[model samples]
Structure formats: C-alpha cells, structure tokens
Target: ATSVRRGLRSTLRLGNRLAEEWWRQGIAWRAMRRGEVVVFDRHFFADYHAYDIAGTDLPLSRRLHGFLLAHAYPKPDLVIYLDAPPEVLLARKGEGTIEALARRRQDYLSLAAVTTSFEVVDATRTLDEVTSEVIALIRAFEQRHGAMATTS
Candidate 1:
C-alpha cells in the first residue's frame, strides 16, 4: 500500500466519485475476471462512504469492527500489518507532521481487528526484513490453501 497520500486524500473530494467507481468497481471487477491479483490497499470497507452517500451515519469504526468479526472480505487470504512505534515512524518521516501520523494511525488501528489472515509486525526493521517477513507469511498461506497462481 505504498501509495500516494495526495491521491488518497483527493478520494474524499467530490471530484473523486468517478475515479472511485472506475478504480473500485470497474478495476476490481476486471481484475477478478482476469484471474489477477487484486491488491486492495486501504479503506474499501463499506461504511467508509460518507453518511450522505451511504444514507446514514453508521460510525465507520464500529461498523468495520463488526464487519471484521463476521469473516468479511475472506480476510483477503493474507493481511500484512506493518507496524512501528510512533516515535520510530516519526523519526523515519523526519517532518513529524501530525497529519501524516494521523493518516497512518487511522490505517493501522482499523487493521487491528483483523486476525485470521493477518500478521502484525514491527516495521522498525530494515526493508529487507519486511520483505522477508511478508514472503514467509505468504508462502505459509499458500502452503495451506494451495497457491492461487496468476499470469499477468
């Protein structure tokens, strides 16, 4: 989910409705059809839609918690939660901006409820370490479920 923060922020603006439909519905549907690996990054939870858009203010956080408990999204086959101490992340980010921290914290907290397909890890380590950890997790999952191989 190493995506552009600016683009994600824009997803909240009015101009992004079309982009959302294109990316979420159109793109995802096509990917599934093609037997492709559709890697959804963040906030595809149903309640993330604004109250006006969704027709009621259902409290996104609580809704997400309940949704996770019911084995939603198939737990995505695997969920790699990259976590680090706030201070470590702050040091790595340098600017120590509250806005940046807030965005990251929100993402992390939301993922905490997920468990079956999730592996929470310390991200204060090296990039190679993170990659190795993720690979091990995926391999273990594939062993259990049989690999869902894709070609392009």
Candidate 2:
C-alpha cells in the first residue's frame, strides 16, 4: 500500500509540474495578458485534490504540491461552478461510477466554499438557462471590471 501511494504521489508531482508549465504557456494565460474575458471549461482549481484527500495524513510532498497548485496560478475573476447532482453528471458524461462522481462533486463544493469569487449554477437546468446564467455572471464581472478591452 505504501509503495502504491508513493508511486501515485510521484506521478501526481510530475503531472502537476507539466500542467503548470502548460498553463503558463496556454491560451488562458495569453488571453488574460491580452485583457480578454477567458472562459475556461475547467480551471486549475477544479483539478486539485479536495479537502477530503488533502489532509495532513498525506505525504508532505503531496500536500505541498496541492498547496502550490491551488495558489500558484492567477485566480479567475469569476468562477462559475456549474453544479449538478452526481447522477446528473454521470448521465451527462456517460463515464465514471456514481460514487466517483459524487466524490468529485463534493470536491468541487469544497473548493467553492473556500474560493473568494465563486458562483454555483444549477447545471441540471436546460442548456439555454445555464448559458444565460453564465452570460449574466460574465456580464456582471465585466461591469465590475469595466468592459474587457483586448490588446491589438
């Protein structure tokens, strides 16, 4: 068990490093620098281990990696968490067991709780409704930040 855990941790570290590098050179970073409203389908925060698995019981390296990944990147101006029941998520994705989906949902909710700029939208709603709500959130953010002006 210890060996398995060690292997997982090593893999996670490498994956995190690669992901961070990619993010630094990714479209999101470029758009942000250009003063555009970036709509990420899934952001870094969404990928971090949640509070449940992020306890001190884990190795120091694992905990440190989680901490750095959670804080390293520039935070999104608005985090619209489109939340739905685990069953709904399972149905939509056609992958993952209900148990796994539920765990992921809890992780997302935990992350949302600690985020300063977070909004939960009912993702089970009709596509139009969800899109409208997301648009409204974006508009509100733009209003607060002034219209996003792209750099030429």
TM-score leader: 2
Error at 108, model 2, angstroms: 0.7
Off by over 4 Å in 1: 1-36, 41-43, 46-75, 95-107, 147-152
Error of 2 at 54 (Å): 3.5
Worst 10 residues of 2 by lDDT: 44-53
TM-score, candidate number 2: 0.74
Candidate 2, residues 58-109: lDDT per residue as tens digits?
7666666667655664555667889999888888889999999888888777
Q: Residues 18-103, candidate 1: write the lDDT tens digits.
A: 34634564566567567655656643442232232232444443344334423333334556667786677778778667666766
lDDT of 2: 0.71
**What are the Cα lDDT values of the candidates?**
0.55, 0.71
TM-score of each: 0.53, 0.74
The local lDDT score (0 to 100) that residue 127 gets in candidate 1 is: 95
